[model samples]
Target: MRALVTGAGRGIGRAVAEHLSGRGYRVALTARNEDELHKAAAACAGETLVVPADITSAVDQVFDRVEAAWGGVDVLVANAGAGSSAPVHRITDEDWSRMLELNLTAPFRCVRRAVPGMVAAGHGRIVVIASVAAKRGDPYVAAYTASKHGVLGLVRSAAAELAGAGVTVNAVCPGYVDTPMTDTTVAEVAAKTGRDPARVRATLAAKQPVGRLVSPAEVADAVWFCVGNGAVTGQGVDVSGGAVQS
Candidate 1:
């Protein structure tokens, strides 16, 4: 299989790329950081192509490069996303736009770009890394929550549209992952609330019923399940540690 993982330089994206590569898929790792992409490619157990580009604006170019090299992508993990925390009334226009651009629009563009090739080839898997916020609201992250919710909607609709084409579209929604991104969130919350960063992180982890933060590898496992299962389309598989059970 030929797989492309966006934001593959770090966090959940890197884990997903490594997991797929270990399973014998020729993977393409993409992110805005060229150096990080090279490092991620080096860690892959199988064949890898490193393509560094901002997913929001370079969706077409990324797919073009991948298709040119590997015929077409058989799996697309749209795992590139960002989150911002702000009171609903205090959220700036720029923050909201950034959240939507990264969390929702970029994944949509990737899905749109990869679909035709998948349809032509008659089989594909697309998994978007969303959040537990997509399932339920949380305070102080209005923009992030909204963007995740929107992406989940996109997943459901796309899965319905592509079900007959041998393409599966789904989402893996996780909560409080133990990633650099979560570290940033912890710092931001500590700065805002005058609390210790460790305390803030512990509080976030406690929100999950598992009493800990989710692992990047755990989220990758969910993505793999979505990719390997044909009957699981249109679902948001929660890797949130029972935080947002449906």
Candidate 2:
């Protein structure tokens, strides 16, 4: 199988790419950072192609390059996303737009671009890395929450549309993950509340019922399940450590 993973330079994306590659899939790693892409490619156990491009605007270019290297992508992991925290009333227009572009619109464009090829081939798997916010609301992150919800809707609708095409679309919604992104969130909360960064980090971890932050590899495991199961389409598989029971 051939796979293309966006934001494959690090964190959940990197974990997914490495996992698929270890399973004998030829993977393509794409992110905005060329150096990081190369480093990620080097860590893959199987063959890899590194394509560095901003997913929001270069979806077509990334797919075209992948198509040229391999026949086409058999698995598409839309895992590139960003989050911003602000009171609902204080959220800026730019921040809202950024969240939507990165979290929702980019995945939609990727799904749209990869569908025709998958339909022709008669089999494919697409997983979007969403969040617990996609399932329920959280304070100080209205824009981020809205974007994740929109992406989950996209996954459900696309899965329904492609149900008969041998294509599966799903979302993996995770809670606070132990990653650089979470580190940023910790720092931001500490700066805002005048609390120690360690305390802020611990508080975020406590939000999950597991009493710890989710691992990138754990989220990758959920993505693997989505790809391996043919009948599990249109579902948001929560990797939130029991924080989300629905």
Candidate 3:
């Protein structure tokens, strides 16, 4: 199988590409950072294509590059997103726009570009990397939460639209994953609360019954399950270690 994974330079995106490669799927990795993409590609088992572009701003180019490289795609993993926490009064237009573009609009564009080819082949799998914020909104990240909530709705809509064509679309929502993003947030918390980074991270982990941040590979495993197993569709499976039960 061939798969297109967005935001694949690092974090969960990188893990997803590596996991798919290990499963014998040729992976096309998309992201804005060329060096990171190359680094990630070097870690994969199967052939990996690097398509460097900002998926949030230049989705059409990304789609064209992947479609041209692979001829068509069997799977699409819209896993690139960002997190922003702006208070209700502190939220700026740019903050809202960038968060929405990165988290929601970009994924939508990837799906839109992939479905037609999938329909032609009569089989396709789509796995969107949503977040626990989609289900449980917290303070200071209203816009980010709203964007992920949209991702769930998009998955539901496409599940119905693509089911008849033998295509399945699903989402994986993870909470407080242990990645660079989480590291940055933990550091920020440390700075704000005047505690050690480890303490701040531990406090966040306490919020989850799992007693730790989810691993990138764990989140990728959930995405792989949804895409590799065709029986599941339109489902938002939580991989947050029971942090946000739905």
Error of 1 at 95 (Å): 1.0
TM-score for each predicted model, relative to the true structure? 0.99, 0.99, 0.97
lDDT of 3 at 67: 73
Model 3 C-alpha lDDT versus the unseen true structure:
0.91
Question: How do these models rank on TM-score, best leading?
Answer: 2, 1, 3
Clashes of each: 0, 0, 0
Better of 1 and 2 by lDDT: 2
Query: Residue-wise lDDT of candidate 2 within 1-246, one digit each (tens)?
Result: 999999999999999999999999999999999998998899999999999999999999999999999989999999999999999999999999999999999999999999999999999999999999999998999999999999999999999999999999999999999988999999998999999999999898898888999999999999999999999999999999899999
Please list the residue runs of candidate 1 whose C-alpha ends up more than 4 Å from where it truly belongs after superposition.
none
Candidate 1 lDDT for residue 94: 94
lDDT of 3 by residue, 120-231 (tens): 9999999999999878879999999999999999999999988889999999999999898888888777887799998898988888898988999999999988987888
lDDT of each: 0.95, 0.96, 0.91
Model 3 — TM-score against the truth?
A: 0.97
TM-score winner between candidates 2 and 3 = 2
Q: What is the lDDT of residue 12 in candidate 2?
A: 93
Q: By summed lDDT, which 10 consecutive residues of candidate 2 come out lowest? A: 201-210
